[model samples]
Target: MEIGFEELPVMNLAFVIDKSGSMNAADKMGWVKDAFGIFIDRVRDIDFVSLVVFDSSAR
Candidate 1:
C-alpha cells in the first residue's frame, strides 16, 4: 500500500544512548558513531531524528 504524509500522523522520535564507561572502550564508541552516521544517511530526509546521549553522571 502507498502511504502519503497527509494520510499519516506526525511523529517524534528520541534516541537515548548510554555513553558511560563501557561505551568508551576500544572501537565501541567509534562503531556507534559510524552506525549513527549510516543511519543519518539513510533517514536524514525521511524523518526527523533527535540524538540524546547520556553518561553515568551526566546528561
Candidate 2:
C-alpha cells in the first residue's frame, strides 16, 4: 500500500506576535523569536509565510 501524492500542496502560514510591554517579561519575546525561527526552518520550499505584529493595533 502506498500513502503518498505525486505532487505536494503549497502551505500558507501566518504568525501573530504580541509587541505589548509585557512581552519583555521573563524573556518571552526571545521564546517567541525562537519558535518562529523553528517554524520557518520546518516549512516547505513552496510555502508562503506572513507575519502580523500587534501591540495596540495590527498593521
Candidate 3:
C-alpha cells in the first residue's frame, strides 16, 4: 500500500543517566556514552533528541 506524506506531531524526549561510582565498573560508563552517540545518530533521522546525564549534579 502507498502512504501519503504528512506532518506528524512533535515529540520531546529526555534521557536521565547516573554517572556515579557504580557506573565506572565493567566499562559501563563508556558503553553508555557510546550508546548515546549511536542513539543520536539513529534518532537524528526522525526526531530531535535531548540527553541529560546526572551524577551528584545534573547537566
**Model 1, stretches more than 4 Å misplaced?**
1-11, 44-46
lDDT of 2 by residue, 1-59 (tens): 75444355787878889989999899999999998999888787888999999999997
lDDT of 3 by residue, 1-59 (tens): 65433354445678888898899999999999899888776553456677778889898
TM-score of each: 0.65, 0.80, 0.67
Scored by lDDT, the top model is: 2
Q: Could you tell me the TM-score of candidate 3? A: 0.67
Question: By TM-score, who's the top model here?
Answer: 2
Clashes per candidate (backbone, < 3 Å): 0, 0, 0
| Candidate 2 segments whose C-alpha is farther than 4 A from its true place | 1-8
Q: On residues 1-59, what C-alpha lDDT tens digit does candidate 1 reach at each position?
A: 99975555545667788898888778788988898888766553556788888886535
Say which prediction, candidate 1 or candidate 2, comes out ahead on TM-score.
2
- Backbone clashes, candidate 3: 0
Compared with the true structure, the alpha-carbon lDDT of candidate 2 equals: 0.86
Candidate 1 deviates by what RMSD? 3.3
